[model samples]
Target: TNLLGNAIKFTDRGSVRILLHLEHGGGAPLYRIDVIDSGIGIAADKLGSIFEAFVQADTSVTRRFGGTGLGLSISRRFARALGGDIVVSSVPGQGSTFAIGVACGPLDGVAMLNPGQVLEAETARLAATEQAHWQFPAGQRVLVVDDGPENRELIRLVLEECGVAVDQAENGKVGMDMALAGDHGIVLMDMQMPVMDGYMATRLLRSQGYARPILALTAHAMKGFEQQVAEAGCSGYLTKPVDIDRLLAAVADALGGRLASNADRAAATPQAAPVAAPTPIPTPALALAPAPALVPAPGPAPHAALPPLVSRLANRPRLHSSIRKFTSRLASQLDAMDTAWQAGDLAELAALAHWLKGAAGTVGYDAFTEPSAELEEHIAEADSAAITASLQALRGLQARIVEPESPADQLNDIKAST
Candidate 1:
């Protein structure tokens, strides 16, 4: 499917075809699939390198056709793992065909459903799951504080589906005001925002004697952030693309109901200590090594590696939809950051980078975190040239944000490989 998708994406005005057949070789059966595309084909010299991770035919290809250059690498890995191999044939200007051959045992007693039937059944199952309603305590209000409009909406949609009432604030100041004005059962506070930040807001809330359970919502899942959240007097913490089940579990636990296990909750909660001057939370970008310079002539695009999305939420279509929406918004956010940089508004630029850093991890765009963090540092140093380079690198990273495949698709690929 990935190969076919890429084929179509690269093809300007040509048909793509898929052919599947069976063959007998050495007393065993083999399944052969061919994906043929009348698209911009690979150069003979670059053909072998294309299957390597981060290696595209050219840098221009990445700008023209967006991809992380990971699909073919992953596909090849899957093929090899399944006792098969993927071979490609291409012409510079004509087209390309990818042949995937996997070894299969004799099918004498096997029952096989048509691929279309299996796909339809799986789609139906997913649809049914999406339609199945979940129930939560009525009027159980939660406060969500984040600068991203799309993120706020995504969280609201997920929580509202579970029958929770949600109030949102665009920044820490508004969050602080709303928290004081309303009776929220719990507060989901983002660690980085303008006008104020989660750390300051949390400290103020604690100092002022408002004692509702506050869960730190952060983009940085690196070491020490949990400690930072704890030090700030938050009750708990959650990392982004917040999983639905985990979010509900956290909420329920915060509200003194145990819908989900509390094993991890202790880590999120503050460890009791005598009050002292707060330890400054280190910026997440500082944790990442600087990315290598972007080579205009691409062999492999500079790899900005990120951890995979949490598996529990990866299977859900709603999460995927949310991710797509978040990534779409990322482009505009980058643009805004550029504008802020051009205007010499370091505060605005820092705030945008901080928000972008936090939000990127939730949607499996961890690669963005480092560049964003670097942007923040550049703004702090008042280095205009560094800011320009970092912003440009961020735009490049944005193109490489790879969406993970569904679990079902993974299983199917595994089965095909074997």
Candidate 2:
């Protein structure tokens, strides 16, 4: 019931049914309780191990459906502790049934709600509360340093959407210089950039006695990067492509006086030298903007008066033109994502899709956000039926961004040009 209850929480349009079978013998009555669901079923090979301690069927499964793998393991343990064993039968596309057998006990007063009703209520309450809180601060300054145009733009879009003024640096050297010159409240520093990477930049900042919070942004490859990020002199670390809620929370934490700890630093270890540049993973059907590409062509410029919000976007001496340039670059990335989807290279399509979901919502592309989110969900599911449906919806969204209200027959004219 516990495991079934959680599955219902994550799954929509799934039926949860419990089957109870009783075997009466001369000695005692044995009871078998089975909980079945039409939701996403566990893979066959994984079904056996899911009940093992500390093991998850897949990491993304955990991310998409949040849980500690301990639930089933604990449930089995409790069942065994009470002189029964639990078993499972599942086929990935079909459904799953978890059967628990035990010695029958006395009748008791146990209350259960209609699963549909409870789940709906919980979902509604959570959605309502989420809509109401809306706690991000307005117009805070944020500096983003990343080598990839996609990454840079994604962060820029996110912060900008929350009404935070944003600035960008393509590499560590530039970001470091910007950090030294600007009066930013926070720095979102990416780990692997040309000229200077996040670690070197962080070390430099700390050496120069820079006290502002710097958050290292990297793909959390393993547990080690967490510690490496901290040791590199960052106050915190966020994994990419960043989750919007997590990113906002980290930003709020840094801004609201949450300080990094030595333990956090010790936990993030440096990644092993790479044999090859990690190929950009396709984001799951999310809308992605291109990474930020800053202008200036490595030349010196005279200082100009920046808006108060822009001034705080960096420690840089002047930021008047940079802010506008950065936002413009972000807009371009959104166009790029739209283009990728039309071309239909699944890899680029998925990457841009995932990026846009996070980027669009963060940057306040109000119309595109929810559809982008739905696109990501369908892409992650990746079933043939779901993907086809999602693809159509995505094309519709692309039309909205690039070609609203054009005649349906002429849609291809506005489709991405690969």
Q: How far is candidate 2 from the true structure (C-alpha RMSD, Å)?
A: 19.9
What is candidate 2's lDDT per residue for 105-199, written digit by digit as tens?
Answer: 53233222344656665665545444432244555688988776655665666566556778899989999999999978899997866688889
lDDT of 1 by residue, 1-418 (tens): 7788777656554467897766555544557787877677778899879999978898776654445578899998998788788888887656788888777754664555556766766665555545544455667899999877756877887777677889999999999999999999999998877789899999999999999999988766678887888999999888775665588778877665433223343334332333333322222210112222222333442243222334234555666766767766878889998898879888888888887776776565655655576677667878666678778878866766656565687799999999
RMSD value for candidate 1: 17.4
lDDT of 1 at 64: 44
TM-score of each: 0.49, 0.43
- Report how far residue 100 has shifted in candidate 2, in Å: 10
Report the Cα lDDT for candidate 1: 0.72
Mind sharing the TM-score for model 1? 0.49
Give the C-alpha miss distance for residue 417 in model 2, angstroms.
Answer: 27
lDDT of each: 0.72, 0.59
Report each candidate's C-alpha RMSD, comma-separated, in the order given. 17.4, 19.9
Q: Which ten residues in a row have the lowest lDDT in candidate 2?
A: 302-311
In model 1, the runs with Cα more than 4 Å from the true position are 1-5, 15-36, 62-71, 78-83, 99-111, 123-127, 172-192, 195-418
Let me know the TM-score candidate 2 reaches against the reference structure: 0.43
Show pairs that collide, candidate 1.
82-417, 219-358, 240-362, 241-362
* Model 2 Cα shift for residue 19 (angstroms): 12
